[model samples]
Target: MNKLFFSAVIGMTLFLGGCMLAPEYDRPEAPVPSELPSGAAYDGSSSSSEVPLVADLKWREFFPDPKLQQVIATALDNNRDLRLAVLNVERARALYGIQRAELFPAVTATGGGSKQRSSADLTESGYPRTTEQYNANLGVASWEIDFFGRIRSLKEQALQEYLATEEARRSAQIALVAEVARVYLTLAADRENLQLAQSTLETQLGSHDLIRLQYDEGVATELDLRRSQTQVDTASRNIAIYTQQVAQDQNALNLLAGSLVPDELLPVDFASVIPPKELSPGLSSETLLNRPDILAAENRLKGSYAYIGAARAAFFPRISLTAAIGTASDELSGLFSSGSDTWSFAPQIGMPIFDSRTWAAYRVSKATREIALAQYEKTIQTAFREVADALAVRGTVDQQIAAQQSIVDSAQTIYDLSNELFTQGVSGYFGVLDAHRTLYAAQQGLTYLQLARRANQVRLYAVLGGGGNLEVAEADFTN
Candidate 1:
């Protein structure tokens, strides 16, 4: 009879496991355009079929620069922010495991013997006697039977939270890679600027010496000598500024890389870091759904729905079971004897009758779910804006760079002619000085344009979810 009763309880617990109180989840509509924005600022080229999607391109393939690949690899291995993101993911997974374990009963076993003395006056017999008892048992303790699906809903919520953390870790990795690339490019541009300043200083020094000789021979005015001296001083000051800037850029790059970068791996000039190939944004904007941050937001929204279900389940009865079977006897040797067998079966159910707190909790869960939904929609909108901004820059950066280069060429020609005419005594030193200034400014502008072009490529690649294949590897903390 006891066996039959226990079997019936187990069957009921398993049968009601599917009874969940949470409402079904529906994904919120994306509050953005289905198509990517197109305009004069956006590239209209049909490269969607010609090039691989940015999502499909690995970071190494997108960069293709061996030195940069090594530097990024080192950053991925050592960066502390990325390391913390990975740890958060692991912690969420463990929490999910703990929540999942609540769905099953915890069984235990016990065996013991006890002996006690009884006083004659207390026993109603005029004699003192010893009493003995022995017992053994194996059964489940008080384990909640999830008949209302509260435990299942909680477990689902935990699972979604774990998934969200995993996506967050992936998002962190993508940002880290993009930042490292940008810092690396900035360092290269600064080095190029330093070189430009040094070269300009050398040229100005030569011109100053020539003007001084001419002034001494009464061939050039004192004003020409002073102007030449001023130009030399300007170049010397620029050299000092650029030298400091270059050193600061290196420090920034080292911090991003999480270690000192070797000299050979560092960029030598503004053009030393080649821009990555143009990425295809695909025909539609739906690709943004694959981005890690957006995915993480969606996961959180799902978790919120699960939480609502758990809250609703709290209104229903909570059932639990506790049962034990054992043998008891006055003599230790009779513990397993015939007719010494014992059994027990217990079942309990509880429901909140007048608890206002339960209703408040339920209301809070619904509010939280609404908040999550709003956040998910906002994330998608933000992603759309980012991609659009990147495309706008992409369409115009190359043309801007080309125009600046042409200006630099024109300035170089003017400076050469002015210097020659001044030396032949057909023109004043003023023209040469003015031309030199124009050429130097134009060269600096061209370098800046080039850097902007490269930076735009990295941004577009990142916004498009490039490097999807590069999983953030777990850090080994055992050492």
Candidate 2:
């Protein structure tokens, strides 16, 4: 018996040392551009790798408008989508825990009671005899011997999958933050434009009234009165259009907040505040690894690699050891007798010789791992593209903003001069009306330009993965 046991151990060792079935996994390289396009220059702001991701940038620091900041805070706390994201993270954690436990052995207590009766009629001649026997035993059974590393590799794969899920949740959260902030900025800009249109409408109405008075007193021609009225009506119609836009923007903001009429108390008005300061761009590509989605992709790739290792291990011969130790007796009272005690240890091996099924499964796992690697690369490239595009747009926005500001200044000057000429009876009402139209266009452009700058800054943080840890209430969350 001792010699047989030694032979079995040696056989198990030899089989495991032979070879495995799955392929080894290595991280696939990303096929990104060798360098940024010539137009890609980070001139908007400089940043350090330590710059917190957009999510990390507190609402107070980025949006100092007390009212707007309050609104952001409320949305973050109450958004239902955010709540779902938190729950997904918890689920991933629990699933990971379960997978990890599989690496350990399990013990079970087995009990059985049996009774047998034999009848003999002709003993040696296959006769039957009247006899009865009762047997009862209880024992512990277990099986464990991960000689091929299958269980270990499986557990590792699960760990990576769990991490990937967590990253997915974080990525969703990052998008939510950016969306909410973007909507808020949009609302503010639109509100200003709406007010501008309304104010211009009022001024035009006043001018029309003055022109009508002059026409009746024989000081202005009928054409001048007609032109003034046309300008007044056009401006009023435009005001109504902008008013509708402002209302629509507010409604969208309400939806993002996951509420109707979104807490009216949350700050809504900031009196033409300057845009956020330009931030610095980082010095290395490694900075991108900070994005939650990117991290999640990395985790997923790792999990795929582990799965390949496990699948390869599956092709190899697997060995398992089972042990049983318990007591057995003919009577319940003698269940613990010396003769009732017994123990057994057995090892088993299974190897496929010509099984197409195993081969097919292993190949499928390999293909899946390759797919995951490709996807990981794709995600990285997309992230880089987003950052590059945002940076490129930023480089030119400042110059354009400066130039547009000039246009606005010039338009204002032209409108003022045209009004003066009319007051002095030196210009026609057509000139004044045309000048006001130009001014209105310039004003709207300026509002859009300002909003664009803020958006670019926010995008920088989003791509950089700048969020801080959240303190969750563990009492209500189960992992």
Candidate 3:
């Protein structure tokens, strides 16, 4: 009984000893710059009206258009890319679990029945025999020890990889939101332009008929009538193209939303769904680190460092302890009897004796760590640039939109005055057409610029690493 107990104790010790191969992991130091470039933001233009980049702003707060907010919300909820991203997170977590478990011992048991026969002929004494053995038992089990920290290093690498996937998910979500915003903005601009084109088409068509009547009375030249007709045709063509663009853009938005056309249809005037105005942009670049892509890079860097440790540990000798305890008896009743008990224990060591290529692996891991560090630094630089671009453009786009709006207003007034003067025979057809063209161009330009400005605001939020951080409100994750 004492021997049996001693065997059990030794088995446990062996099981525990098998887990000593774990390697410690540490983060590699990389010199990160203190601050992003303090250039004159926004493509480096000399503009005094520049606002510092603020990446934080809720999409709802930025556009204030309830309709667009609804669209964005719907997209966020139903997007297939988002669903896939979530699945990826699960996959990474599962891998982390698998790797993390490697540092611990695993135990399993086996039971079997075997029959053996031995035959000898032409020996000192010919012997023929058949034996049947039945085996059944259960005990602790283990494998290679982790004393050198190999498993620990591997586990750390896996954990970092898992974190990387999470960052990737967030990155995908950010991209999805950005695309939705851009498409929605385009929808609004296109719809507005279409309306303008239709209105101009009607006005020009009316003028075309008037010029025909004047030509019939021999008061207007054939040149004037043909030119008026040309203006009406041009407006009509533009409206057709604009109408097509709206349909195509809607389809594009639907694809991003990952919905069938029959499921949900966005309106042509998506500005009705635009987010709010006067949003708050929380101050600073701390929010940039929270961005999923940046976090992903950080995690990858961690993994690279872990891999270096793993590679270094590979250069050391590997030791393992193993043990098994069970019972074997010819009779079923003796299977659990003390007399039938059997056990085996082993300690093993392995070293790479002749593998000349091992040194290359260490070099590879070291190089990979360097690459990860560089990328980490580069990512920071990119983040700063994005924030600065968004910040610099906010005021610039605002000013441009305002200036363009003024131009549209001025052109409209000039067109109205020119049309009046032409009705009184004080202006030529060419003058009226010129004024109409100016108004058309200005209005279209204003619509486009307005959409661009709004889109920039959306981009700003995204660039600032907005969203997902409850503590930092008003950052632009909606880009």
Best by lDDT: 1
Tens digit of per-residue lDDT, candidate 1, span 180-245: 898888888888888999999999999999999999999999999999999999999999998898
State the lDDT of candidate 2 residue by residue for 6-72, as single tens digits: 7978786678643433355555555665443343365544445654444446535655555555556
The residue ranges of model 2 lying beyond 4 angstroms of the native Cα positions read 2-30, 33-69, 111-144, 218-230, 259-277, 328-339, 342-346, 467-479
lDDT of each: 0.86, 0.70, 0.72
Angstrom error of the Cα, residue 416, model 3: value is: 1.0
TM-score order, best first, reads 1, 3, 2
RMSD of 2: 5.2
User: Between prediction 1 and prediction 3, which has the larger lDDT?
Assistant: 1
- By TM-score, the better pick of 1 and 2 is 1
Candidate 3 lDDT over 149-191, as tens digits, reads: 6777787788878778877887787777778878978877788
- TM-score against truth, every candidate: 0.92, 0.81, 0.84
Which stretches in model 1 have alpha-carbon errors above 4 Å?
1-15, 44-46, 111-115, 118-121, 132-134, 327-341, 469-479
Best by TM-score: 1
User: What are the clashing pairs of model 1?
Assistant: 22-309
- Give me the displacement of residue 7 in model 1, in angstroms: 7.0
Tell me model 2's lDDT, rounded to 2 decimals: 0.70
How would the candidate models be sorted by lDDT, starting from the highest? 1, 3, 2
For each predicted model, how many residue pairs clash, with residues at least 3 apart or on different chains? 1, 20, 35
